[model samples]
Target: MAKSPMDTLQLSYIQIAIAFLLFAQAKSTTEHTSTPQPNDTNTACIASERSALLAFRAGLSDPANLLSSWKGDDCCGWKGVYCSNRTGHVVKLDLQGSGYTIDSDSRKVLAGNISSSLLGLQHLRYLDLSFNEFDKMQIPEFIGSLHKLRYLDLSMSMFIGRIPPQLGNLSNLQYLDLRSSYQDRDIHDGTYSTDIMWLSRLTSLEHLDMTYVDLSAIVHWLPVVNMLPTLKFLFLTSCQLRTSPESLQLSNLTSLETLFLVGNQFHQRSTPNWFWDLTSLKYLDISYNGFYGPFPDEIGNMTSMVELHLSANSLVGMMPSNMKNLCNLEVLYSYTSNINGSITELLHR
Candidate 1:
C-alpha cells in the first residue's frame, strides 16, 4: 500500500524516535554492568580470610577437637573471629576462650608454634593468643613479618626463654603484652641482652608491658626507650629497677599518656627534674617504690591527667596549689606517704 508523503514522513519520524530510545536504554545497561561493585569484592575477601583461618587449623594436628566448631561457609558465625565490615578482612582473632588442648604425642598445643600459615593473613591486625600454653616454643621469626599487626596479646601464655629480638621487626606493632602469672623465673644467662638495643627498632610501638621480666640491668637502658616518639604507655611492674635513671630524660615522647613504675626501687631522691616534663601524661602510678620527696610543682602542667597514684612512697610535701588546674583529675592515691594536703580542696575541685 503506497502511502502519501506526509504519512511517510510521520512514519520515519516515529521510527527515529524509537531507535533513539532503544540506544539510550542500551547505553544505560552497559554503564550499569561496567561499574565495579565494592560490596562483591569485600565479600570475596572476607571469604578468603575465613578460608585462610580454616587452612591454618587444618595444618595443625588437632587431636582434641579444639577447632571443630570452626566449620561453616559463614566466617562471621565462627567463634573468636572478627571481620571488618568495610573491607571484609579479618581484623581480630580472640581465641582465648576456645578449648584448645595439648597434643599428647608432641606435647604441643594447637597454634603453639607461630607458623607461616598464620603469617599468611596479610590483613590481620589484632591477634590474641592469651590463656593458651605455648611453652618453650621459640616465637616464629616469621611473626615479625606481619607488617599490618598492631595489637598483640600473648599474656598468660607460658612463653619461655628470652624474647625474640626479631620481634623488633614489627614496625606497626603498638601494643605488646607479655605478662605471665606463672612465667619462668630462671633468667637464662646470655639468652637475652640486658641492654635491649633491639627495642629501638620498633619505631611505632606505643604500649610496652614487660611485667615480671628479668630487668635487673635493664634499668640503665630505660633512657634509650625515650627514642620512641609514639610511646605513650609503659608498664614495668616488678621489673627490679633498683633506682630511677639519673637523667630520666623522655622528653621526646611528647605523646606519653601513662607511666607505670610500680614495684620498683626508684627511691624518691632519684626522681629527676625531667619527670615533671611529661606534659601529656594522663595517668602516672609509681607506687610500691621507696620514693621520698616533694611531689614536683610541675604536676600542674599535666592538665589532662585523670589518675595519679604515688602510694607506698615517702613523699613529704603539701599538695601543690596549682593542682586545681587538673580539672580531669578523678583518682588520686597518696596513701602510705608523708603527703600533707587538705582533702577538701581536691574534693571541691
Candidate 2:
C-alpha cells in the first residue's frame, strides 16, 4: 500500500487540480475588488449651463472674488449656484451683495452688466442681484423670459430707466422686490413705471416690494392691484402714488398681512373707507401721506392689526371707541399727528 505509484500519481493530480481551483478563486476575488465602479460624486452640471454661467460671470466685475468657486466644470458646486438633483439644472443664482460690505471704499459689490446669457438657465427658479451696482442700467427685458423664476429680488441695485413690461411674463413669480432709493428718482435716470398694467398679470404674486419706484404716472393702479388675490405683503413706500384706497370698489386682498404705503402722496381728505375691509392685515403703515381729517371709526374693524403706524399725517380727534376691538394690537405709532387718544384704554382692551 505504501509503494503504489498509481495512487501517488492520482494524489498529485488531485493536488494540482485543487491548486488550480484556489488560484482561480483568488483571481476572481482580485478582479471583483479592483474593478472600477460608477462615480458617486454629486451630479455634474450640464456643459451648456456651465458655459452660460461662465459667460454670465465674464460680464460682471466681481471685485471681491465672490465667484472664485465658479471655475470648476460643475457649476452646481459654484458659489450662489444651486442645481436640481434629478435633472442637474441650475435652479438658483443668488449673487446678492448683502453678503459683502458696501460702505467702504473696498466695496464688495458686484458691478457691471448682467449678461443675457442667463436666459440659458431655463430651469432657474430664484434669481437675486440685490444691493449690487449696475451703473443705472435699465433692467433687461430678457429677464421676463425666465418663466420658471418664482423669486426675483433686485432691490437697491441701481437699475434705472422704465421698468420693462416684459416682467409680466413671469406668471410663476411669487416674490418680487424692486425697492430702489427715493433719491434715485430723477427725471432722466430713475426707475419709473408709466404703465404698470402688467402687474395685474402676476396673479401668483405673494410678496411685492416696489418702494421708491415712481409709479405716480399710473392713475388706475389701485384696481390693478385689487386683481391680485394672493398678495400677502405689499410695500409701495414712497412710490409717489396718488391713488386712494377709496377708489377701489371691491378689494380682493383678503390674504394681505403687511401693507406699507408710507411716504406716498395720496392727499386724501380722510383715511380711505376701503381700508377697514383688511381685517386680516397684521401690519399697516400709511404714514407721511397727506391725509387730513378725522380718524375713522373703522379702525375698530381691524381686529387683526398688530402694528399700526399713522405718523406724520393730519388726522385729528380722540381715538375711536371701537379701537378697543383691536385686542391683538402690539404697537401703535401716531407721532407728529393731531390724534389725541387715551393710550391706556386702548392698550388695556
Candidate 3:
C-alpha cells in the first residue's frame, strides 16, 4: 500500500517499457542464435507483413486473449511480434500492458479499432502501445508514417486528439512517449499539442516524454528543447510549461541525464538559472512545482545528482550548506516543501 508519487512515476514508466521489451527480445534472440552460418535461412514474416499483422488482428478489442499468439504463418513467431533476423522485417511491436490488465476501469482492456493496418510494418522499429485501451482514439495520423521509428510508446493508450504534427517525421526518433494522466487531464481533455516546432526535427532525440501534455502556449519551448543534440531523458510532467527560460543558454545540453519538470510552472516561473548548466544531471525531478524562494545554491552545482526531487514545492530557507556537494546523493524529495535545513549536517554528509 505504498505506491504514490504518481504511482512511483507510473512504475518508472513501466520499467522503461519492460526494458524495451527485453532489448527487443534480446535482439531477436541474438539474431537467431548467433554464430550459426551455413547459408543460414529462416526469413519468414513478410507476407505483406503477415497480412499487416492479420489486419492488425481485425482491429483489436481482445479482452485478454492476448492475441492468442497471433495465429499464422510465422509473424516471426508472433506474441508481441518481433522479426528482423537478417530482414524478416516486422521489427518490434510490443503490445504493452504486460500480460494484460492495465486498469482504465479494468474490463481487461485492449479496446478496438486502430486499423490502417499499421501501415504494413515496413521494417518497423519498435512501437509500444502502452497499457492498451484506445477508447479516446485519434492519435493515428498513420502513426507518422512509421519511417523506421526508433522506439515510440503511446503512453497509457487512451489516446485522444491532436498530438501528431506528423510526429516530426520520426527522424529516427529515440524513445518518445506521449504521456497521459487521463481524467485529471490537460488541454481540456482533448489532449494537447501546440506545434512543438516538430520537436526540432528530433535530431536523434534520446528519451523525451510529454507528461500530461499541454505545453502552455509553447513559446519556442525552451528554444525548441535546446535543439536536442542527442538529449538524454527529459520528461515534461504535467506540462503546462513555464519553466522560466528567457535564455540561460542551454547549448548542447551537455548530454543531459534524466530531468523531469514535474507539475510545471516553477512557482510562478522563478526557479530558473538554467539548471546549473546541467552538469550531467542524474535523475532530477522538479516535483509538483510552483517553487517560490530560498532553496537555491545552484543545487550544490549538481555534482552528478542522483535522484533529487523538490516535491510539492514552495521551498523556503536553509538547505544549501553546499548540500555537502551532493556527492551522488540518493533520493531526496521534500514533500510540500518549506525546506528548513540542518539535517544533522545533512545526515553526516
The residue-by-residue lDDT of candidate 1 on 1-349, one tens digit each, is 3356786566446433543343334334432432222233234345667767877776554554566778877665466666666676666776653333364454323544545677657877777776566656544567777777777767656665576777787777777766643434466521223666767888887777776666766655666677788887777666667756545533677887777777777664624545567888887777777878786677777898987777667878888889988899987877666766686876797
Q: Considering only N, C-alpha and C atoms within 3 Å, which residue pairs clash in candidate 2?
A: none
Off by over 4 Å in 3: 1-45, 60-86, 92-124, 128-133, 136-150, 156-178, 181-210, 213-231, 239-255, 264-278, 281-295, 299-349
Error of 3 at 84 (Å): 6.2
lDDT per residue as tens, model 2, 1-349? 1326776466446433543343334334432432222222486789999999999999999888889899877788787888877778888887888433555766667889999999999988888898888876998999999999878888788889888999999998888888774455574666889999899989998778887899988888888888899987788888988867673567789998878787899888766656667899987878778888988788899999987877667889988999989999987767656777577888675
CA lDDT of each prediction against the hidden true structure:
0.65, 0.79, 0.72
- Give the TM-score (vs. native) of candidate 2: 0.85
In model 3, residue pairs whose N, Cα or C atoms come closer than 3 Å (at least 3 residues apart or on different chains), thus clashing, are: 267-290, 267-291
Count residue pairs with overlapping backbones in model 3.
Answer: 2
* Candidate 1 clashing pairs, residues 3+ apart or interchain: 268-291, 268-292
The per-prediction tally of clashing pairs is 2, 0, 2
- What TM-scores do the predictions have? 0.71, 0.85, 0.33
Error of 3 at 5 (Å): 30
Per-candidate RMSD vs. true structure? 24.1, 26.1, 18.1
- Ranked by lDDT, the better of candidates 1 and 2 is 2
Tens digits of per-residue lDDT for model 3, 1-349: 3347886677557544643453344335333432122211376767888898898889887877878888868777777787777767777787776424555445444678889888988678777787677867768888888888877878777777679888889898777888774736555564688778888898987777777777777765877888888887777877777756634554787887777776776465434557656878877777666767778788888899876767666778788888888878866766566677566776677
Q: Considering TM-score, which of the candidate structures 1 and 2 is the better prediction for this target? A: 2
